[model samples]
Target chain A: MGILEVKDVSKRFGGLKALSDVNLSVEEGTVHAIIGPNGAGKSTLLNCFVGKLIPDTGSVMFEGHSLLGIKPHQINQLGVSRVFQTPEIFSELTVFENVMIACFAKRDGSFRLQPFKTVENETDIVEKAEQMLVDVSMIEKRDMHSASLSRGDKRRLEMAMCLAQDPKLLLLDEPTAGMARADTNNTIELLKDIQKQRGITMAIIEHDMHVVFSLADRITVLAQGTPIVEDVPEKIKGHPKVQEAYLGTAH
Target chain B: MKILGLNEKDSRFLLIVIFLTLATPVLLQPFPEGSGMAQFNAGYPDLMQRFAIFGIFAIGFNILFGLTGYLSFGHAAFLGIGSYAVVWMYKLLDYNVIWGLPLAVVVSGIVALGIGFISLRRSGIYFSILTLAFAQMMFVISYSDLFGRFVGTTITNGETGLQVYGNDPQVLLGATEPSSPHFFGIVMRENFWTPQFGDWQFTFNNGYYFCAVIAILAFYLSLRIFRSPFGLMLRAIKTNQNRLNYTGVHSRPYTLAAFVISGMYAGLAGGLLAAMDPLAGAERMQWTESGTVVLMTILGGAGTLMGPVLGAGFIKYFENIFSKINDNVLHQWFAWMPDGLEDAIVWVLHFFVGKGWHLTLGVLFMLVVIFLPGGLVEGGTRIWRFIRGTDRKEKTADATHQPEHVAYVAEKEEF
Candidate 1:
């Protein structure tokens, strides 16, 4: 059995079927990529994996446990983390503070009411967050407000936040969607370095073919809420359905 | 040499500020006693009391507004419930503040939990409207004749206010006469202080000081919370609720927790107010009173640590000072001008001062909202930035760095 498995998951919004009979399996410690067009239900499927939206049918299993009825925060406790398309760093918080929260969440499960306690006292979590920041090359700007970071730096910080959680599975939804070409390249390199060093499994949603070709060990092409093809990067690059659904527009 | 990786200068500055704040009543005690100074002194303690009480109110409101970005319009009901609970304690078991205060807090907290759990199900404008509706319902119930017209829903004994005589047998300390409940030659006079320096006399009442200490503690607690991991999660929920959920963090429980904590803070403030004055009236729970806390938070800079206190002090000061000024004072100030012009000045002042102080308040609020959306703290920061000449570069850098396009796309993607 794969480390994470989704079997025939389907979701509907009113009359519109957002996802239909989608099936995929991700092995442990592999960089998996989901590439698709705008309305292909990539986000909906990601939402299902994290328990944000329960699928109409089918089951998502992480490790040996079923992820059907678990709450969203409970899912995070089970070692699954997701990064949004827009770098959702707390704009009002300092970079160090932003990562520190993630570290605390990972250590103490959600709903801790230790109001008088200090976050600085958690030496282990602090050390882990500091190490993650260094890995992402964000140590220099750690004191700066998260709002003040460059687009590329924001993505890196978001990645660091996810890393601080020490998750087994990291999900990224269009991690480099609105970044400039240079920033996009920087993010690709950062993700590649992190994957190699940490050996954490990641399932990324991407529109940029270059990022997909460079880092993906395996690729799944989603079109109109269905996984049309799932294969290695070389085979995915030349697949007829993927080309027609996604690459044709690019050409 | 850097402790916890924080700058020494910043740490030192913080230490000094905390020290000064803790020692304010003792350190700032030697100003003079003329009419002007006496007026300032007379206002100081009451202003300080308001600063703490309303500061608590706003801080609680901030948990909902600052963390979750949900504007609650029924927070005053919690405050009212707290005050009423204290009053009931005083009526049933004499003025034993120890019991009254804790009872008030517990009662208010339970009420807040019930209200917050139900209200948090809705989001955005609907949530705000729902809270407003509940507050109005509470106000109506409090004024309804079901509780008797003379007693109202919660009569405050004709506004003579409840008095804690300190002579009841049930009180922890031994019973004493109502007029002089002395312990070691110092009478337990709630409002007794006379600081005379030349022509200026400044008085700081014990009751007011008691309230001040509570307020300071509340402020410090709020500061700690703002720096906590839970606070960060609340802000994350505010910034993007969807993202928090997608990250396997349920937004509901976090938001509900913030709402309840804030409600408890409001309750504490209300209990303190009753402790100082020993009165609980239905009017305190009015929707307008709830709106006032929102005004304080917004006016002071909603998310900043000290902003709400400053906002509360500002509004309370104006309420006291401006309302005291009548047409006579206005006429006296404009007497030197030409008759027609002086009359005109008096007329305009009449429209804003005295009973019309709310008009002045309204205008001030509008100006603050339009010119300084971040409120008084932002205005002060802007002034400081102008003096330092470092604002322009920072603004430009901040503008350039934010991922606006990504935010826009994400917003569109939500549908």
Candidate 2:
């Protein structure tokens, strides 16, 4: 069985159907890419996975448990982590402190109150955060405020923060949305290196074809509110439906 | 190197608070009694008691507002609840403050838990409005004879407030009860060390010391909270609640915990107020009183360790000292000037001194909020950094290395 199973999951906002009968299964050890145009319900599906929304029908199962009727933190506790489109980081904190907070969240559960113990005393979490920063090549900028980092570096730091949680499944929502060419290439390489080193399962939503082609082990092209094609990158590039989906909308 | 799990800097801050609380009587009495400046001296026992009491209140308020960025507009409800609890305890029990204080804290905590449970369901302005509504409801319930008509008993004693009475049943005390609240024969109002040096006489009152010790403990507790992981989570809630939830941390419980703890602190302050003065009034629970605590935190620098206490002392000093300055005093200060000039000076100062202290406070609050967004502590940091900048300029001889962002200014202010 796959690690994640979403069967007949549908969501409707008032009279608009955001998702309809979406069935997606992500195998335990694959980089699955969800690619679609702007209004194609990609974020809605991602939000459904992380308990930000409850589908009007059907179920989402991560590992062996149902992910419905639970809080967002409870979803995170189930080894699912998400990187936002806008890098929703603690802008007021240092990079190290930011990653360290995630590490603490991973080490301790959603509601542990260590009111007397300082974060400095959590040596294991600190070491893990430092290690994650090194993996992301962000150790040099660890002391800098998270807000001071460039857009690309902020995404990298955000990735490091997610990695610090030791998530089993990482969800990326347009990770390379607003990066320069150099930064986007660097991010692809970094994400590729991380996948190779850690064998982490990532489900990325991307509009960037280059990033999708570089990192995705499996590609699912979504159109309107349903998946039109699921294939390898080579097959996906030459698919007739993809051409119609892209070319039909171009003019 | 650490006290109560706080780091060296935090420990030092708490130590300074403890030292200052202990030395308040001496430090406030800087001027000799016969000097003109003695009129500005804030060493009187009642004023000192107010300083300690309000310091505790503001520190408690800071835990919710400063750390979590939750602006509660009804925190004074807890204070009022605490005072009422204490007064009820004294009326039923004895003149001993020990019986009333603990009950006050417990009742206030329970009331806070109830209010917080309901209010925390909503955030931002909604949360603030909920708390305000609860406080207003309490005020309205206690203000008139609603309770007297319904329950056949006056719970808050209506508008005159709840207080210890003469003819009440004294099960805890024998025939005679002290005129004021006491702790096992230690009178709250009793003072000593009236030795005169020149015209200066510094009276050390038991009431002030009692309140001071508790306030110092409250400060230490708040300092500990500021350094703890829980405190970090509270700050994270302020920064981004969504991010915290995504990080596998529940934001509501953490914020609720902060709210309840801060409420208890307000309760403790209220209990201390009643312990010293033995009165509970609904006016103390007004939303405006809650605004005063917010002003203290913001004016002193919210989220800083000592800001709330400093802000509380500043406001209390202004309320007591500046409000005491009349046109006559302003005339005395300008006596050396020509008669017309002296009159002019007094007239100009009249808009700020004495009864116009509130206007002065309003202007000062606006200036601090506008120019120094981080409040008085931020201004101090700015001055400190300016001094440091000049010192570094002499050595570095180059301006390129100094980044011109507000990032450095904020990060460097922690120490």
Candidate 3:
């Protein structure tokens, strides 16, 4: 069975059906891309996975545990980490602190009240946080405030934060949406390296064809709040159904 | 180099705090006795005790408001609860403050848990209003002695305040006990030593030292909290709760723990006040008292380690010394100025002194908020940097760097 399973999931916003009868599963240790045009329910479906939205019908299970009606932090503790469309690092804190928080969460679960213990004395956590920064090539900027980082650096830091959790599933929502070509290529390379090294299961919702084609092993194409095509990346490249979803049916 | 599990830098800070608190009686009495500026001297036992007590209160409040950015507007209720708890202990147990003080902390912490649980359900202004509402309800109950009426005992004793009655049973009282809030027979109000140096005189009292020691302990604990992982989580909450939650750190329990801890601090302060005076008043729970701690925390520097203590001392100094400056004091200072100019100046200055001391505080608060958003600690850092000429060097360095790096430097100064 897949690590994450979505079965006949449907979500509606008042009169509009944002996601309708959507069924998808992400296999273990594979990059699964959910790509759609502007009006499709890509974000809505992703939100449902993260406990930001409750589906109107059907179930979403992560490793056989239901991912519905729980808080975002609880879902994260259950081994699901999400990267937002915009970088969501703690802007007021230093880069080291931003990653250290994720490491603390990973080791301590959703909550641990260790008020008397010093952060500097926690040797293991400090080492883990430093290693994560090194992995992201952000060790030099660790002392610098996260807010001052360039957009590309911020994205990389966010990725490092997600990876620090050692999450079973990583959800990426348009990681390269607002990046320049060079930054986008850098992100693609970084993703490829992470996939090769860690074999992390990633569910990416993307509008970028380049990112999807470069990283996704399995592709699911959605149109008008419904999935129309599901296949491997090579098959998805020239599929008529995918073209129909993107460019609309002839005439 | 590391004492008390703290790093070298933190241990140094703690040592400095301990030295300053212990030497307060001497340092505060810089003016020689009977000198022209003698009126500014705040080394007296009553005021010195107040400085330490409120320092503890503000330091505690800073953990919640400063770290989590949870602005509580009803913390005074905890203070009142603490005072009442101590007084009740005195009535039921004995005149010794040891019995009452710990009870006060426990009582206040329990109460804070309830208040924090309900208030924390809402964030931002709603959370503030919720705490305020709870505090006001507490004030009304204490003011009217509603609890006393329901329980058929003198709990708060209403507007008359709660005090040890002659007829009440002091079960633990000994015939030889000094009575009237003593620490194992050492009277709180009595001064044990008065040392004179040149023209300056300093009086060291039993109660001030007690409060000073407690305040130092409280400050040390706060410093530890600031460096702790939980403290980092609280700051992360302040900056970005959304990111913190998605990272698998729950924000609610952290905020609640901070709230309860700070409330216990307030309780300790209140109990200390009662221990010194042996009286609990309903007025202690007023919203104005709640606002004062907020002022102290912000005035000192909300997020800094030493800010709250400095702010508490500053406001207390103003409340006592500046308020003592009346029309006569103003007239004495401006006597040399031409009569009309002196009269005009005193008339205007009078509004900022005496009962109008709040006006001076208001102006100072406005100036700090506008020019030094990071409060007195930032101002101190700036002046220190200026003296070292590092600020100029940094500015030059910043000018040559990329724009984003410059923003980083500026933001670092605010912390």
Candidate 4:
């Protein structure tokens, strides 16, 4: 059984079927890639998993717990972290403050009233945040404002912030989109290092074949709101249905 | 204990507040009593009392507007309500400020809870309009005197206001002598010490000190709120509520808490205003008064620790100094010039000061908003940066960064 199971899920926007009877299973401690062309139901499928949009039918289970009609925060508390397609780091705050808040959330749970406890005095959380920054190689710019950072650096910071929670499952929406070649390679290596060191289960939705082929242990191809194939990355390379999905879109 | 969760930096700020508040009488009365500039001295007990009271009002308003970024246009309702509560306390019980203050706080808190519960359901401009509507409704109720005027029936006594009268039910009073509002027999208007140095005379009254002490407490509490984790959440609400929700935080409760706290502060200031003069007027709760506090917060630099107090003092100082400047004073200053030119200069200046003091304030507000958007505090910081040859710290850096990130992390750590 997979850590995350999407069984017969279907979502519609009025007349259009964004995701129809979709079934996805992300096995624990493995990198699963969900690849699709533009306008495919990849985003819809991911949104359903995260509680942004509720499927009209089907159940999404994380270790046998159903994720339906729950708040986004509750879903997050249930060990799911989503990284947006565009970087959503707090632009107005310093790099250290951004990571520190995440550490507080990790330690304190959903609601807390330790308003009097100084952020500087919380040494353990501070240390953890600093360590996370180091892992992402962002320690040197910890005091700098998060907004001033390059786009690639913002992405890295967002990932580091997510990792700080030590979540069982990580969701990445085009993690390497808009990244320079060097930064993309660095991100790939970082993902590999994290998977090796921490064994985090990641469900990545990507348009970039290079990113998918490089990191994905298992690949799922979707065309016209339906999955055509689910197989290892090497087998996905020559799949005719995948070719039809890509080349068909070209026509 | 730490008194509102003050850190080292906050503690330092509090110390400065305490020092400045205590030194107002001396700091205000700089010139000799008979000198030409003596008229500009703000050392008078009544004016000083106004500084402290309005300082309290602005500080409380700052806690809500500055931190949460919720522009509440109805806060003056709480202040007016507080004044009424105090005045009523004097009429029903005795002329003691102590009895009125706690009741005013409790009543305003309850009122704010009701108002905030409904208003917070909508955010941004809609929320501001809702609050404005509620306050206007309250003003009508108070101004129209909805209750029947039978004995002690009229809730707010209309334009005449609810004042201490000849036959007040002062059951606590043993003395036959007429009493002004007092804190333990120390009369509000009575000056305790008047020291004269050459032609300079300085008067220190019981009321101003009492108000200053309260203002100091208010500043301390504000400092605590600004530093606390609760404050961080409010800042998060200002930045992005969606991010907070995704992070697993229910931000509504935090915003509501800030609203109630600031409302109570307004109530306290209103209560003190009544204690100082033993009268309550419906005009105290008007929308313009609400706008004045907003201007004060923005003028002083809203998000900063010391901005509200500085803004309050700055605005009040201008109101007092400018209003007192008549055409005679203007003419005197320009007498050194040519007769026609002097008359022309005074005529031009007449539109700015004296009876046109508010015009001066309007122009000042415009200039501040245009140039020093961070308010007076930013101006001070900028001047300091210039003198020290240092880089300008950006004002765009906000509280949004802290809580959203925390929530983001919380989502990840939930397992």
Candidate 5:
């Protein structure tokens, strides 16, 4: 059994099968990428992993735990974290506060009702969040509002927020979908750095072939609600079926 | 603690604000009654009292609306339940406040838990409608004659409300008061000192001061919550519920906890209201009252620390001052205008202001929603920025950096 495994996971929406008989396995501490055209069921599969959607007939196991019926937060508690395609930061709050919340969650669980105390007083949590911010080069923008940051900076802050949780498996849905070339390169570098330092397994969904080639150790090509190709990035790039299914649409 | 990013300076600033607030009644003692200064004192304590009470209400509501983005329409029911509990305590027990207040808080919290559990199962407009229905049900129950037709939902016994005397044997012995009441206190006979000058006088009362102190404590408590990790989680809930869940934070418990905590604050406010006069009526839980708190939160600025207090003061000030203005007052102001023109203007003013203060409020609400969505705080910030010549500079800079169309396109693409 791999560190994370999905077996025959199928999801149907009304008459349309969003995901059908999809099987994939993620080895520990490797960067895995899922690439497909729009409506290729990449996001739906990610949703299933994070418990956002329940699969019709499948079992998702993470570190020996059954993730099928678990809630999203419960999945996070089980050493899994997800970053959405869009930057999701507390816009009104400062960058430091945004990361601090995630750190608090990792340390204190999800629900804490300490009324008279401040979270910053927690030394260990603060140190971890600060280190994560520094790693993402967001320490300078820590005091600025997350909403006021540039798109690249916002993504960095979001990455720091996810990292603060110290999850074993991180699921990223299109981390560089709308970013400029420079920002996308920066994100790729950040992901590389995180993988090197933390040795945490990552499952990233992306449409950009450049991002897939640069970062993914293993690439899975999904099309029409099924996995068409799953192999090393080099093999995935040359696959005839993946080219016919995905490259045809991209061109 | 400094761990959450709040340092000594911010805490000290809050301390000074609280100190000035608590000392206002004593510091303004020399101001003559009916004079502007004295009116400030006379009006402020009650207004500040509301600021604290409703601040708790809004903060609790904010937990739901701000964090979860779930707007509740029935929060007034929680407040009403709190008030009714306090009033019942006054009737059954003596007004020592030690037991009555805690009981009110606990009961209200329990009620909130029940309401939140049921309401949180739904999201968006459905959740708001569910809450509204619950609040209306509470209002109907309170107004129902099934409880007691003549006694009303809450009975003050007399206009003075429930009174306690030191001479009362049950109170002195720390026991529950008997059904039959007899004695009144000599303490009531002494007239408190009132400083007067010409047309104005400043009179101080112990009851008002007591409520004022409680209000200050509540305000300080809310300030703490606003800066706490719990508050951060609530904001995260508001910003992106799905993101929060994906990050492994269970949104339900956090939202429910916030609901309960806010309910307790409302309960404490209700207890104080009863303590000041010693009567709790079911009418306090009306949907209008719930809407009033929403108005207070939005009018202040939903997420800002001090916005609710400012909003509460603005609303209460309007209610007190605007309600007093009559047609004669309008006629006095516009007397210099030509007779026909003055009469027409007064007629029009009558439709918008004076007894029709709601019309003015409604217009103000629309203006705030459209022009100042951030409410009074944002408006004040805008004015400050304008005075500093930074507003134009900031907007131009923002405009050059990101075109509106591009941002919209980016947002649409993400969706």
Candidate 6:
């Protein structure tokens, strides 16, 4: 059994079918990339995994438990972390505080009314947060307000926050969607380094062919809300089905 | 060294707050008695006690609204509940204040829990409206004695207000016990000292000291909460509740906890108000009363440690001293000028003092909100930075170290 098992999951919104009978599993320590054309339900599938939306049918099992009928925070406490497309972060707080709150949530679980103990005195959590910032090459900007961070740096800070949680299964939805070439390359290297060091299981949804080929261990290509091909990157590079899905029947 | 588990900076801040609170009677009586400016002196027991009481109220309100960004418009219900609880305690037991104060806190906390659980389901304006609705319902109930009519007995005593009646049972009362509200045998209303120094006279009332001590404790507790991990989570809720939830932090419970804590703070203030004056009015639960604390928190500096206290003192000072300056007092001051010029001065000034005190407060609030979005604390910081001549230097220094993109982003976020 894989760490995350999504079997025969289907969802519909009014008359439109967003996902139909999708089945995928992320192995223990590998980068699983899901690539698809626009309007192919990539984000909808990712949302289903994080408890943001419930599938109309089938089961999403993490380890041995169901991921449905629970809150976003509860799913996170189950060792699953998701990075958003637009980088959802605490903009009013400092970079260090953004990571520290993640660390505190990881340690204290959803809710702990610790009104007396000072945040600076939590040496263990502080050490972990600072180390995460260093790993993301953001330690120098730790004191800077997260709102003032550049878009690329904001993405890095969000990565540091998720990493601070030490999640078992990391979900990335277009991690380099709107980045410059240099920023995208930096993010690719950062992910590669993190995967090599921690062996963290990641499931990335990407449209960038270069990023997918460089980072994905196993690639799943979906067309019209259904998987058209599931194979290694080398095979997916020359697949006729993926070509037809992306370039139309004229190809 | 740390005092009360606080760090050096926090401990120092607490010490300063305590010193200022305790020295209020002496400090407020700046002008000597029989002087022209003596009308502005607010060193009497009544006003000093009010400053401390309202200071505690604002500090607690800040913990919820300032930290979690949950603006509760019905906090006055808890305050009214506290007053009723204390007054009931006095009627049942003796006039000793010790029994009623703790009961007030407990009662208000329970009420807050019920209200917070329901109100926290909504965020932003919806949450505020829910709280306001609950408080309005409570006010109607208290004002018209709805519950009392149901029970066939006077509970809140309706419009006349709740007080210790002459024929009521005082089971804990002794023949020699003090008649009014007291801490054991010590009367809260009695003035312990009135020392005359040169032309100044300072009155140290037992009731004011009692309220001041509790206010100091409340301030210290708030300071600790501000530095705590829970406090960070609360701020995280304010900034981005979505991010907080994704980070595995439950925002609802944190907001609820803050609500209960602030309600308890309001309750304590209410109880103290009753202890000093021995009266509990239904008007204390009015929606306008709730709005006053919101104004205090925002006017002072919402999230800062000392801001609420300063805001409370400022408002209370103006309410008491400024409102006392009637047309006659204005005329007396302007009498030195020529008759026509004096009339002009007093006429213009009349709109800012006495019955028009709220107009002055409204104008000042507008200026603070417009020019200083961070409140009075921001104004103070700006003045301090100007005095030190470091604001311009820091901007230039930052421009050199940061990239142009970063500098642009920083400038955008400055406001």
Candidate with the greatest TM-score versus the true structure: 3
Instruction: Mark the regions of model 5 whose C-alpha exceeds 4 Å error after superposition.
Output: A247-251, B1-6, B23-69, B145-193, B197-199, B383-415
Question: Model 3: what TM-score?
Answer: 0.96
Clashes of 3: 0
Could you give the candidate ranking by DockQ, starting with the highest?
A: 6, 3, 2, 5, 4, 1
Docking quality of model 1: it rates as: acceptable
Pick the winner on lDDT between candidates 5 and 6.
6
Give the per-residue lDDT digits (tens) of candidate 2, residues B297-357: 8898787767788899899999989999999899889999999999998999999989999
Highest-scoring model, lDDT: 3
Expressed as tens digits, the lDDT of each residue in B1-415 for candidate 3 is 7789898977887888899999999999989988889999999999999999999999999899888888999999999999998998889889999999999999999999999999888887778889999999999999999988999976898999999889888899898888789889889999999988899999999999999999999998998898899999988888778889899988999999999999999999999999999999999999999999999988988877888999999999999999999999999999999999999999999899999999999999999987887789878877988888774434322210111111100111010
Residue A204, candidate 2: C-alpha displacement in angstroms: 0.6
What ranking of all candidate models by lDDT puts the best one first?
3, 6, 2, 4, 1, 5
Better of 5 and 6 by TM-score: 6
> By summed lDDT, which 10 consecutive residues of candidate 5 chain B come out lowest?
B406-415
Scoring the B chain of model 3 against the true B chain gives a TM-score of 0.94
lDDT of 6 by residue, A91-161 (tens): 87788889999999999999999999998899999999999999999999877778888989999999999
Q: lDDT (0-100) at residue A246 of candidate 4?
A: 91
Model 6 alpha-carbon drift over 4 Å, by segment: B336-338, B392-415
Per-candidate interface C-alpha RMSD? 4.9, 6.9, 5.8, 5.0, 6.0, 6.2
TM-score, cand. 4 vs. native: 0.92
Q: In model 4, which runs have C-alpha deviations exceeding 4 angstroms?
A: A249-251, B1-7, B147-152, B176-178, B393-415
| Shift in Å, residue B5, candidate 3 | 0.7
**Model 2 clash pairs?**
none
lDDT of 1 by residue, B32-135 (tens): 54443333342455555666578778877776675567788899988887887777666665555666777877887887778877877877766788888887
Full-model lDDT for every candidate: 0.73, 0.84, 0.90, 0.83, 0.71, 0.88
How much of the real interface does each model capture, measured as fnat?
0.43, 0.68, 0.77, 0.38, 0.64, 0.82
Kindly give the stretch of ten consecutive residues in candidate 3 chain A with the minimal lDDT sum: A140-149
Alpha carbon lDDT at B383, candidate 2: 86
Among incorrect, acceptable, medium and high, the docking class of model 4 is: acceptable
